[model samples]
Target: MASVADNLTMALRKQIGAKLNVLLLRFFDQNKSGEILSRVTNDLDKITETLQTGLLKLLVAIGTIVGSLAVMFYYDVLLTIIFLVFMAICIIITRMLAGKNLKYAAFRQETLGTLTGIVEEYYTGRNVIKAYNHEKESMEQVCANTELNRKATQKADFLTNSVNPLIRLITRLSQAVIAVIAGTSMLKGTMSVGVVQAFFQYVNQTAEPLTQASYMINTIQSALASAERTFELLDSEEEIADTKTPVVLNRAKGTISFEHVSFGYDSSKLLMKDISFTVKPGQKIAVVGSTGAGKTTLINLLMRFYEVNSGKILVDGISSVDMTRQGLRQNFGMVLQDTWLFGGTIAENIAYGKPDATREEIVAAAKAAKVDYFIRTMPQGYDTMLDNEGGNLSVGQRQLLTIARVFLCNPPILILDEATSSVDTRTEKEINKAMQELMNGRTSFVIAHRLSTIRDADIILFMENGNIIEQGNHQELLIGNCETGLQA
Candidate 1:
């Protein structure tokens, strides 16, 4: 039974992990990571414990009760009937307590999930909290969550622990009444002392298991609450299924167009309405906007990270919806402001985009991105092991490694979303020089707040309130030649 329970738990964890992987980005946006993690970890542990011990104990208690009752009946049918009446009362009381136990157990789990979310948030933002001198506020918030969890847990434990003693009290009273009746029969010479003693032995046997069974049942009920939460996550909606026969784009020519594209994080309130734009092959398009002007949203739509509500995005003149997501994304290389590095050798991090890259190829890509010298200066050079997120390297160094990763892929299209924002002016100029050579024959989309960096872009798109307000080359925008109301 223990082995079966363990294997089942492992299978369930794997299934939940797989489901989370395919779920849409919207699901993640709506749910807290820590809450989801609690369901997968703590709740599953509760289920495993119940299955391994509580379930087995309950089964044994049931067998013992049955066997004891059989012997009691053979010894004296009248006494057995009386005993069963008392057992029925015990069952009714236990059923009532079990119902309350389940309610408290569910409450306990919910509070635990909330507490987990609070802790996770505070831990990740500890640096910001300290910088802003908000440590006291953070501590208070965590304490409040912890208090709620404590109350919920206390209530649930009280119910579970109280069941066994309550059932035992009822059994003891029933035994007292039975003892009186047997003693009277013995005094009247109608029942033998040996029979009376033997009957009491069976009575004890039945009562003991009844007590154990009641406690185990309550414990199992708590686990059932946890199981319900796990099932909720499994039942969450998944991403829309891929087409039966998706269009395959092996090597796109990097022509992208957004025709009447409309979208919103919430479908009812469209953020980008009837937005249309087109880009030719090998053109540099710069998207410039204030905060929350939907620059990133446009890129997200192009990459199909979030689906459009009422229009089409085309890659190489083919509707992107018809193409496999992998096929569409593989043709575009992205370097974001936030660099992500794992615990691995520097060579492995550089070769992330092209896992099978040769050592010579990795070095070449690093050199193109202007990070090869830094790599060589490290104690182990390309083989140096990086901690999580490359903690040993400065932010600029990490950004350069991510840039090198994109260089290795050499995709048909490139996306640089504040890619140079973290680096110094000298490093930024170096990256820009390398980027110019890299964008020679490939389409590129640059999302930037630093307007000077995109001065030479083939076209500039000025967006506001999710609409393209003005667009032209830098010189045209500056000279006001396109006749748009706004100028650069």
Candidate 2:
């Protein structure tokens, strides 16, 4: 017959394999999971071992008690009752602790997860602290969270640690009481020598597992808590839904429309209300406003990152709902406000998510975005390692590299979010010339605060508090005191 260990391992593997989203998260989880897996295996293995050991001792205790009872029952009834009462007390003590201890163990495991999240946050941003010389403050933050975790663990362990000595003390005291009662009965010639000897042996066997069990509960509780937290994360709502049959968008002409769209992170407070707009194919639209004017929200809606509260967004009169998120995003290229570069080669970063682009295409995209010049001058050229989120490159260079990524993607609809903010005026003009060429026969949306770039846009929108308050060609918004000089 297969061992219990083999059966448990097989069951665990099957459960883990069944939940795809949970399984994916586990693959990404590099911390604690390995230890947790080992712990479950150990705890379960010991349960089998503990049963074998505990059962044998229990059987021996029963035999001794029976042998003593046969003779002792013939002694005074009071002596038999006295010994039985103390044994009952030990049983009650063990029963009370078993369930309560398990709960504390779960709470301690949750505290550990919070600590891990904080540690992972710091490790992910270590270079940010180093580059800006924020190491002291970052170190202090980590220390504070660590101390908090230490206290939480100590508090949870307090109950577990106390139960063992408390249970053991009660068992010892009860055994002493039983011994006295049996000795007194013997002196009265009410019990035989064999009976007293068997009574002592029975007491040891009965009290041993109870005392051992109190300590065992502590370990079992901790394991239970870990399982609860892991399961909680796994059960959380996934980011996107999988369709039984997904819609396939074969081609895009870049026509986008928003019909009375509204959204908010919280439903009670609406961010954008009934905002409607239409972009014809190949139109260059500039969304201009001060900070917090909901320009980014508009881009988010276009990308389908967050669902609109009401109304509809359509591409070529096709409802965004009909398109899979992947299909919707594949046709639109975006450069975010927060410039992100992966840790890899200059060439590899450019070809991200578009693995089949040719070497000549990658070089051409980099040249168009003006990143090729810097990459060529580097010690290893396009093959240089860019650890630390490409911190070795300047902010402008990183932004250009991101632009090169978009150029390689070459979507029908392009979003440039403060795209020219990083590069110098000279470099801006060069990128602008290239961008103008690239914008041919494609719809584009530019989010900008700088006045210079908007002058060349075919249409301008001045949004305030999510409404299009002012709209025109560049000259129209400029005449309304947003410009430096006289009105048109």
| lDDT by candidate, in order shown | 0.90, 0.72
Estimated TM-score per prediction? Answer: 0.93, 0.75
* RMSD in Å for all candidates: 2.4, 6.8
Off by over 4 Å in 1: 74-76, 184-198, 475-488
User: Per-residue lDDT tens digits of candidate 1, residues 15-117?
Assistant: 9989997788898899889999899998999999888998888999999999999999999999989899999998998899999998999999999999898
Q: Judged by lDDT against the true structure, how good is candidate 1? A: 0.90
RMSD of 2: 6.8
Displacement of the residue 185 alpha carbon in candidate 2, Å: 6.3
